[model samples]
Every structure is written in C-alpha cells, then in structure tokens.
Target: MKISILTSLLILLSLAAQTSPVLKIKFDDIESGNIFLINVQKELTDTLSINNGKVTYEAKIAAPTFFYLIVDGYNNTRPLELVLSSQLTEMKFESYKVVGENTVNEAYPNSPIFISDPNNNIAFFEFLSHWKSFYNTIQALSENDSEEQLEKRKNTYHTFLSTNKQIIENNSDQYVSAKMIDFLLNNNLLQFETLQTYYDLLSPKVKESYLGFKIGEKSGKAGQLQPGKPAPEIALVDIQGKKYSLQSLKGKNVILHFWSSSCAPCIKEAPDLLKLQQGNTENLVVINFSLDTDNSKWKKGIERAGIEEMINVCDLQGYNSVTAKSYDVTFIPVYYLIDANGNISLKGTLSQITEKIKEDMP
Candidate 1:
C-alpha cells in the first residue's frame, strides 16, 4: 500500500511538470543582476532576478511567442530577442565581452547561442541574420540615383525578397515562418497580396500561433490607407498640452509626419520638413506626430531639431497610440500627404513625398 501511494504521487508530479512551460537561462560570466523579459505580442514586461548567474522563467504560454531580454547595467548591449515555447527551453550565454580591457562593455553579440531550443528559435535567429545581411548590403550601396546604381539596388531588393520567400516556404510548418512573415510585414517589405500569399502557405498549426494571428490582423489592416482612401482622424496633444486634430486642419493640404525621437532618419529629415512647411504655410500644414513614450524626450527632440515653428503633437503611447494604429504605421519616418479634400494623396519616403508636393502644389 505504501509503494502504491508513492508511485501515484510521483506520477502526479510528473504530470504537473509536463503541463507547465519553463525557461532556464544561465550566464557564464555574469553573477547577479535584474533581467527584464518583454513579451512582444502582449507588450508586457516582467522583471526576473538572477541568482548565482542563472534565472528561470515559467509561464503558461498559448503558443510559441517572441520575447526581448534586457540585462540590467548593460547599457551598451541591445535587447536580446528570443522565441520561447510552452516547453522546457534552456539557454546559456557568455554575458561578458570577449575583447578589450572593458570586459563588461556594451559591445556584445546580437544574440546568444541557445543551448537547447525546443521551438525552432534557432531558425528564427537565422531569419534575422539573413535580414541583417540584406540590410547591411543595401546600406553600403551608393545612394546616387544613377542608372547603374538604381539597377543594382533593384536587383538586390528583389533578391532579398526571393530569399525570404524561400526561407518561409522551406520552414512553412515552423513558428519561425510566422515571425519571418511578421518581420517582413512590419518593415513594409512585402506588398499586401504577397504577404497574404506567404501567410496562406503557413501550416495550419503555425497559422494558429500567436504571431500568426498578429500577422493576420496586420495584413487585414494593410492597404487601408492607400492613396485614394480618406485619411484617418488623429487627435492628440502636444508636449505643452496643446490639443490638435486632423479634422480641425481640414481645407488645407496636410502632411502627416509620423516619427519618433529615437529614429535617426526622422531627425535627419527635420530640417527639410521645416523648410517645406515654412515655404508653404498658406497651403500646407505639417503635423509632426511623434510616437515617443517619454514626454521629456519628445520636447527635447523637437527643440534640438529646431522645428519649433511647425505644429507638433504626441500622445506618449508610442506604437500603441490609436493614431499610429489607425494609420497602420509600423515603421518610422513615414509621411502621408492629405490633399485639400482630406484624401490621402500619397504615402512614401520624404524625398518621394517632397517630389509629389512640388508637382501638385506648384
């Protein structure tokens, strides 16, 4: 009778362990610090304490989800992204720097080597690697619009698209495919139809994943703000608590400048934008809608850029702002030109928008 009771207790414990998802992470050189785990899908952050160079996280996950791990006191290191599952996943990392006298410096690998990943996180990292490679190649190319340079850029972009499509096709059954599709969609790399196609090719299990649902939602919202559609209303307050709305600025050609303080490209285009607004004050209104979460930083960015003359507004919700979602803004430095009739005339980069303005307003 005693043996049978003990066996029953052991089986119950095993069943309980199997039902819970666990993640165990070990750092080789780091001893103790607070690590923040950010759930990408839910936008929730949890602080986990590290004891003796290790930390363990346990949660009931519906599906494989993406998370960002930010190490405390590592100001220079970017947040590490990982895909986690509802199964036991173990990971080890060399937290300290390999070269230089400052071993604890900010320079670190983009991602850590996973000791054990039950949920195809390794493949997700490979997808990110490919994206980084393509981005670097494009960034290194000449910026001139010469025929040869333009052709090279076109070929490079097409090649990247093809490579990403192949990767998604090869791993259609994996959760990483959903992540890859999400990345492409967020970056505005794929068209609406192509995004739908890639999403359709995903396995049914992957399509039911958390990221897959998010991709479906994003795709549904895509192309809603096309050139001919009515521009969505944006109501928000500026840094000084001054309220502004797109409806109030009607009957004038409006330039909805979606940006953030952290985006370098946005800051770089501030001067040009300021000039454009100044030159066309009678017919043009440039609304600088900032996606900054911090109030102080938003004020400072505007002051530093010296665009105090233009109308500025922010809701301090960052990407979660309703204005951002209504416009389907996933990337930074996006510009939209709403004509006098309050219709979206064009949406593109600053240069493209500038050319359109010149052609239409002239």
Candidate 2:
C-alpha cells in the first residue's frame, strides 16, 4: 500500500548523507511509460530523455547494484544488471505476473513482470482505491477538527495506517510493502510510536522502532518495545477469576481488541466488532479485552453493546491490566492482530481490525 509510519524515519536516516557510493543512471524511452532509476539513499536523480522508451547511462556503483522506480503510477524494483566492462547498468521492467526463466519461486506468483507488452501487465495503481479513500477521509477530517477532536481523529487515522502495516507484515516477501510502511511512518501528522510497533512486527525488516523509543523510564508508551524481543507475556482474568496469558494463545491468529465503558471511543467500536465476529473471519481468534475499572459497569456495558455472545474477558485493572502492561496498551479502542504463526501483525482500530480479518480470511 504505502510506507508505514514506523519505517519512514529509518528511510530518512539512510538517505541523510548518501555517501554510500556514486551511481549515475540514464533513462530510455523504448517503453510505454516514463521511467527512471533510484537508490534508497536518495530520491531519483539523473533522469535522461528517452528515445522510443529507452535510455542508456554510464555510472559507477560498488559491486551490488539495486534500484527502484515509479513509472507512471506503479512502483518496481528495476533489476540493475551491471555490465562491468562497459560501465553501464541495464534497468529492466517486468509485470508482477510475468515469470522469467530465472524467476525465483515466490508467493507473488502473478506479481508483475516487466513486459513492454501491455497484455502482460496489470496496472498496480488500480489496487489502491481502498487506501486512497481512507487517506482522503483522514485529510478531510483533519481540516475541520479542534484540539480535543484531534484525540479522536488520531485513533481512527492510527487504525488506518496500521491496516496497511498488517498487509506488509502478512506478506513479508513483498519488498515494496516495506517501502509503503516507510512512507506512512514519515508523515508529520501521525504519532511515531503507534506507527513503529506495527512496523516492527513485519518481516525481518528491522527489529528497532526508532521513533517511539525512550531511553528513560518506559511505562505507558504505546510503541516502546524492548529490543531483540519475543512476544511479551500478557495476563488477563476470565469471569471466574482465572488468569489467561497472551503467550498461551499461540499457534492461532488472535485479536486482542480492547474496549471500555469509561472510554467513549471504545464504546463506539463494539458493534463493528460484533459484525466482524459474525463474519467467521478465518484463522482469527478475537479476544475482547475490556479496560473498564468497575466490574459491575463492565458487565452491563457488554450487554448494552451486544457483544455478549463472543469470547470476552477483562483485567479489571483498567489501564493497569496486567496483560495490557505486558503488551504496552496505553489506549483503549485499540486492537492487536496476532498472526496464526503467533507473531504480532498489527495494533490499531476496529476498522483496521476488520481489514486484517477480511484480508487474511480464506
């Protein structure tokens, strides 16, 4: 979809000095769309006029040459094959679905292949309408909201970004997915830590969440994770006063979605979750973890919300919930997506939670 808010900071640091190496690139016009080569350390540079859709260039780069490009509206890793003797690099484009003689076995089988033949390529931009709609809503909402309204706005926007992050985490083999995560994290309007936890869980991209980290006392930060981490053990109480641990729910796709009567935002999300639960979402085990402090009120609120028929529990500690502490739960109305393999996939909103369910369902 787009770079996650968590990875944008890393991208910015990697590009700060660009002393990595000197690489000159030129464009060719022998193809159907506009194209150029770029290094991750910097934006695209040295674009040349292409004749008939092809351009050639003489450039110097240290041994491994890798480049990416956005031609028209689609993004791709333009295979950079170095002709050492000629000091020229050849950039080739392929449709995601095109398979070559040497193509590696991958999950994205129908992913694009670089064919000048239009019949062989599917326009990648068409897949992004859902995202564009979400972003447009965030933009419009932001323009009219006041300071207090921003708190409410932040949660919804956070959830939206987390949904895209889940996609990247769910499909780690797709390298471009990480790029999208990076772009989202860099946006100035979003919270850094909320972005990072979602970013860190995907693939082996990086184990660090640089933006949300704190060197001092670390209680209550949404994204501050201990480095080189395993899943934090979380403990919650069932109605019978029996304790349940987050670690115990391994080998299943778990949804640790939080809601509370004290929180107006949390109360508003319950019905949507009820709808998600009814969908029989595949491989998803939703745990409706309540953050309400008063036990009597908590029981009544569930009946009122109509989520009484699902797997629900509470820590009664409210924000001090034991399992919530382990998972670093600062905000109510937030949800965690744990993949079937037990790795954390996402942490965000009910809508985002629903998106992950719809996406991973068979």
Candidate 3:
C-alpha cells in the first residue's frame, strides 16, 4: 500500500514538472525594483519585482514564444529591451546604463561575463559577436597601408560570414535563426545575392514564422519583375473606398510607388513626383500605395503633398499591408515602372525611374 502511494506521488510530481517550466532572471547588481515580461504576440505584461537581485516566474509553456524583458532603470533613461524566448530557462545579466535609445554599455562595472543558452539561443549572439569583432578589426586597419593587414581583414570577414552561415544552416528549424535573418536584413549585413541562399537553408517550420515568412516573401520576390516580367497583381482600395487593381491600369505606362507618410524621402520626393506626373499626363498613370495604418494621417499626407492627381490607396496595414507584401516593398519611396503590356520595365529609386523612363521613352 505504501509502494502504491509512493508511485502515485512520483507520477504526479513528474506531470507537474512536465507542465510547469520556470523562467528565472538574475541581475547581480540590480536594485530591488519592478520588471516586466511582455508577450510579443498577446501584448500582455506580467510584472515582477526583484528580490535580492533575482526573480523567477513559472508558466505552462506548450510552444515557443517571444517575450520582451523591459527593465525601467533608476536613472530615468530609455527602458532596456531584452528579448527573451521560451527556450531559455535561466538568464543572468547585469544592469547597464543606456548610452543611446537603442544602445547599452555591456562593459558596466561588476558585470559578469555571460553567454546565451546553447540549446537554442546562442547562434544569434555568436553571429553578432563575430560581426562586431570583424568591424573593429577593419576599423583598426583602415589607415594601415600594409597590404598584409588588408588581406588579413578580408580573410577574417570571409571566415566570419562562413561560420555564421553554417550556424544559421545548422539551426534552420529554430525561430531564433529567423530572427537573426531579420537582424541581418535590417542592418544591411546580408547581401542581396545571398538572400536566397540563406532562405533555402531555412526549414519549412521556421519559414512559417512571422520573421521567416517575411524573409521567404522577400526571397520569392527578389530578382523577379525586374524587366519584361509580368507585374504582380495588387488589389487594394483607395482612400475613397473604391476598388483598384494593378491589372486595371494595363494600357498605360504605370508607376506603382510605395511610400508612407512618415518616410522623409517619400515626402521629399513629392515635388519631383508631381513634376513627373505633370510632364507625362497622357502616357502615364502613377498609383501610390500608402503603407499607413491611420486613415486620418493618410488623408492629411495626401492633402499636404498636393498629390490629388495620383491614384492613392492605403490598405492601412503598414508593413504587413497585402499590397506592400505583394511587391516586397520593404523600403519606402520605391517605385516600379510597368509598361503598357502590364510588364515591369524598371523598379528602383526615383532617380533610377527618371533615368529608365528617359532611356525607354526616347
């Protein structure tokens, strides 16, 4: 009877262990204060206060999740945005002063050397560390006239990229790998020709992640619709709530311009765009896709820019707008010129558009 009781107790403890996974955070020098764990998807914030420089939270983590560890410091500067993942069980770091909005000094006093969990999180930090080291080496050799130094720097960069590529390829199934790709893309560290190579290395499961899907969408659309390719269809509603499709403007030379009201370059090019429209009214049609969420802001930008003559459409979904995704419009103030046959003739900056138009028109 005692044996049966013991077996049942062991089973219950095992089940409980399987159900609850604890996230433990330790900051050696941090004062006893409040910290927050914010669910990136749900936007739910769970507050916990430090007790003797440590805190722990337990949850039933069935699947992986991305979270933000927000530390509001005593100095009253910007909050630290430390990204956390469900894969990590414990995190150890030291409180650092904010030097800039997105910068933190890791060399703060009493800060112990730390490393990410090797189970799932280390690849990202490894890539970042190597990249930063390579950058510093290049900077140190910038004024050095020695050919050997330049050659050594080149070899070091090549090796760094190769190692990171292998790391990404090895962890292709993890969401962290996809996040690393996003990091590289935002920093312009990954070359355009190499996008497809890294994308192909990703597992289908990782590709389905939010960041992975964006990378996949970009890779699928990159080098496509360059010249003579049929332009991808864009179906969206204008600010007036009327439906318009990219195919509808087939007969005219269509300029599909992607922009946002907040983009400085887009705003700066307003006069030049107006001039472009005025010069080619009969032969051209400029359709602007505004990746703006707020209807009021889109309306005000249109009014302020005096671009009433152009076809203005806004799905109001910002970066995730269907029209923007269809064109892979990652950067703003991008324009694509489609010929009369609904085929793309050029896709680039405003100046490139001007040059391409001049080259083709004459």
Best by TM-score: 1
Instruction: Indicate which candidate wins on lDDT.
Output: 1
Q: Please write out the lDDT profile of model 3 over residues 1-362, one tens digit for every residue.
A: 35688899999998866734346778767758887777765678888888988877766654455565666554234332333544446667765444344333232122223344533655656666666676667667667747687577667756766888888988888877776777666654554336667888888877776667778756544356557788888777776777766677767898888887755457778889889878888888888888789988998888767787678998789878776766776656678898989888877677878787778775
Better of 2 and 3 by lDDT: 3
**RMSD of each candidate?**
9.6, 18.0, 10.4
Minimum summed lDDT over a 10-residue window in model 2 is located at 117-126
TM-score of 2: 0.39
Give the least accurate 10-residue stretch of model 1, judged by summed lDDT: 98-107
- Which clashing pairs does model 1 show? none
TM-score of each: 0.56, 0.39, 0.52
Report the C-alpha lDDT of model 2 over 1-362, residue by residue, as the tens digit: 79997799889887663443232223332244444556544344555444555545444443322244434333343232111211332324333233344432223333322323221112222223335556666656666547566665667666666665556555443333433444443332223244445545544422222212221113222344432235566666666565666567666677777677655556667777777776765555677888778888889888877777777797678767677667665555667777655566766566766776678774
What is the Å distance of residue 157 in model 1 from its true position? 1.4
Across residues 88-206, which tens digit of lDDT does each residue of candidate 1 receive?
78878875443333432222353666777787677767777777777777666656746687667768877988887888888888888888888777675765446667878889898
